[model samples]
Target: MADLPNCPICTMPDPLLAADGYECATCGHEWLAAPDDGLDDIRDANGNLLADGDAVSIIKDLKTDGKAGGIKVGTKIKSIRLVPGDHEIEARVDGRQLLIRAAFVKKA
Candidate 1:
């Protein structure tokens, strides 16, 4: 049998490969096959895959509404958290939590 990835939802070792995707034997969960290594679906401005706890730098200046000043280019952010949404990254900048778009950053 071909090497199949474990179930993503249940972490089952034995997942049955189906025509559409994979089905977990233990939890009966179904999910589509991962694209490439599947380390992360998020990518930086340079197309580098971003993982949790990675450091990134802002490529462009971003202005925040109702706040004086803003995030500037080349600002380094460490220990970023990957999130699911329109804003794909979560991090703390200057003691404020910010949700950042992937296109504005590059892996540092």
Candidate 2:
């Protein structure tokens, strides 16, 4: 199949697949991977650093009067994705997974 195939790692030229990942022929460094669409970072309510796409717990009980209402403390959120904002995470809890400001939710 003749096509413009760039290195999966560096998005540059493709090398002979070394061990697992593709190595950049020019840089001499192996590029690891591309993050998944769901892969992202999230912070906790106390403002602590959390991992990208992690399950976190709500330390403080949250009261929402919107479409999705009320998340209690110690609630666990799964597959939380981080975005760039004052509130960094997009997550779901209870009946609705919603965008949560990282300053509000902490890493479980």
- Using lDDT as the measure, which candidate wins? 1
**RMSD, one per candidate, in order:** 4.6, 8.9
lDDT (Cα, tens digit) per residue for candidate 1, span 1-108: 788998888887999888888899999999987755433589999999999999999999999766898899999999999887789899999888999999999999
Candidate 2 lDDT over residue span 1-108, tens digit each: 434346654677655455655566766666554446543544466766777678888777777768555887778888887766665677766667677777766667
Model 2 misplacement above 4 A: 1-47, 67-69
Worst 10 residues of 2 by lDDT: 34-43
Q: Which residue pairs in candidate 2 collide? A: 40-52, 40-53, 44-105, 44-106, 45-105, 45-106, 92-97
Shift of residue 100 alpha carbon in model 2, Å: 1.4
